[model samples]
Target: MKRSSPAQISPDFRRTRVVDQTGIEERAARFTKRSIKQSSKLQALYQVLNMIDLTTLEGKDTDQKVRQLCYKARHPHDELSGIPTVAAICVYPNFVRVAKKSLEGSGIKVASVATAFPSGQSTRAIKLADTRLAVSEGADEVDMVISRGKFHAGEYAFVFDEIAAIKEACGKARLKVILETGELGSFDKVRRASDIAMHAGADFIKTSTGKIQPAATMPVTLVMLEAIRDFYYQTGKQVGMKPAGGISKSKLALHYLVMLRETLGQDWMSNEWFRFGASSLANDVLMQIRKEKTGQYQSAAYFSVD
Candidate 1:
């Protein structure tokens, strides 16, 4: 798990990898066409439930909100009987201690967003302090945003060094690098960012911060997954993928799973290697599971609105 310094990373970030947009779009579309048996659908639904990172990131967030989110992450649906809890509870750095205490012994991790979060427009000193505070507060994972401005300005070395510094600041906690692909403006940029992140020591490459439009499209995720697949082939190292934002339906989650299975095989199937950074996605999955069990769908009001 040794991380590469900026000096060790390739300087040619402008062309780390080029993406074929038409082929990526067509391939991504084909994944949705795969037919699933009812039994397999149910299994996928449960798997989706387990792979979710129930998240709550907002300016008006309160201690009570983090606790409630932690409760949901631990319980999910008490009546489901044998249903698995979510993989983690993601929140702001200030609430990491609250979420950590609330999820004690439940096996659910507390993930905090750092590095100025959605904007990532701040000094590197502040970003490292932000990461350290979360880890000190008992966060099991740190989700950080790469400096999109620097990346766009061709300051790839700065971006790589920042991530490596944050990875070091994370101590024992896992680091999830948010590429915020929505603003990258092209599939080629997304691929380049993904390569930079994995090389700079990102435990996971995330699609978005959930604050931007067009977050986590199948085509974009496909590009990132393909980057991960290629990087693994070259380095024999495994990196996780989390397509955050805009994915709230069970069918769409199943499509992403199909793509992951086909692209990365069974080694990356678990929550350890794949995650959905969508809180609302949990409710939709629960509804699907209940529908499968009772032959009917439950009203959305039946679930908590955290």
Candidate 2:
């Protein structure tokens, strides 16, 4: 479903309107007001667990850590009996093989970050090699960083070609382009970047790398979702969304679900089209699910930390 090439993208992307920050923020704020009660809240909590891309991308991360994370993805809250596993386990490309082995046949995907993650500052050859290595190591998905420096410098073609090239390198692995909205500086730029990624063959247009400080705010996410909506309306292609970073509370994840359902409708509610890129979010969600089922708040110790 990838576009023919970057040449087909320039026209539509150039026509993108400047997003209104105030209007986007106001609309996003109202989404949190939707009331969710007992049974529905419990279901949404479990959905949050399934939609999470259980991530651990740290400089200090080790082989043992990736294995532990993959285990958590397969057996999140085993004591709960019927709890669903997370959608995937996200780690550095070096851990793709380790995570692949640990999650084999369990159906939990191993997502690896490539393209000089959190900092897209490298040659195109290096980035493609980085992605090829991860896919060769059995990554089910690849989350890649865009060249923010080039994007900010108005080098739209360069950024577009880079994503397209990386998409080719991904082979069978689904490609998620991390726009890193925190560094983009404006909602309009975020929308434009999203357009570039979506048209350049990104299966998912993600909001952050979870490495920067201001990653994945509601307003920013709203902007990207709208971009996805517009792109889908025009292309008949259904791209996915993943809001990574700082979303720890179950309530917040539910709010994001509400926003997604309202903005893109119920068809995009499934894990196939939506995901949460977070590390500690699983434990919080586990606690909420347990509280709903047993009427007691479970401690963090009961849940595995990915």
Candidate 3:
């Protein structure tokens, strides 16, 4: 497919919505107050398990670690029958091939963090090359961090073009632009970054790299979801959302699902359109599932700490 030029595709960043801080915080708080029944809670726990992108991005990562994560993704909890596999296995670019080979035919995607992940402080040439390397290594999806420095300097066009260039380099792989909302500092900047990414052809807009503090808060995610909703309305295009880092509880994941349903509606409920970029979340969800089935909570020792 031919890619659109940044100038021809990107929306006017200056016109992006100015997020209402108080309103966003209050509304996001409302999602937590929602009461879920037993049956619905069980269903939501299963869905949360299915939507997780089990990840291992540590520098100490080895082939064995990637393989183990792939095994866990394939069989989350063998003790529980009918437990669905996770949405994907996320790793650094170096492990993309290892993960792809390990997860062959399991229908789980291998997502690689590219474009100088967690910090977009490299040259454009290097960033594009990083994206190409991941794609060439058989990555189904690429998670990229935007140039936060440039965005903070009011260099919106540079950030947009960088994302577009990386999208072009992604080829057939889905591109996930990580805004690193924690570093973006404010909800308004988060909204602008979301628009820039969607208009620049991001298949998904992610919240963090799990390497930064204050990553992926409910208010921040709410702002990004609203941005996605407005973009879908304007262009008739759909983009996925991934909230990485700091979300480790099953109840919080359920609240996120409620916020998604209320904000973007049912169209974005599936794993294809929404994902939780978490490693520990899967174990919590599995524990909840086991609890739901046996009427007793199992020790976290039963789950692997990947």
Worst 10 residues of 3 by lDDT: 1-10
Give the alpha carbon lDDT tens digit for every residue of 259-278 in model 3.
99999999999999999999
Error of 3 at 80 (Å): 1.1
Task: Encode model 1's per-residue lDDT on 178-275: one tens digit a residue.
Answer: 99999999999999999999999999999999999989999999999999988876667799999999999999999999999999999999999999
lDDT, candidate 3, residue 274? 100
Query: Model 2, which residues run further than 4 Å from truth?
Result: 1-9, 12-14
Better of 1 and 2 by TM-score: 1
lDDT tens per residue, model 2, 35-64:
987999988998899999999989999999
Q: What's the lDDT for residue 1 in model 1?
A: 34
TM-score of 2: 0.96
In model 1, residue pairs whose N, Cα or C atoms come closer than 3 Å (at least 3 residues apart or on different chains), thus clashing, are: none
2 against 3, candidate with superior TM-score: 3
Tell me the RMSD of model 3 versus the true structure.
Answer: 2.9
How good is model 3 by TM-score?
0.96
RMSD of 2: 2.5
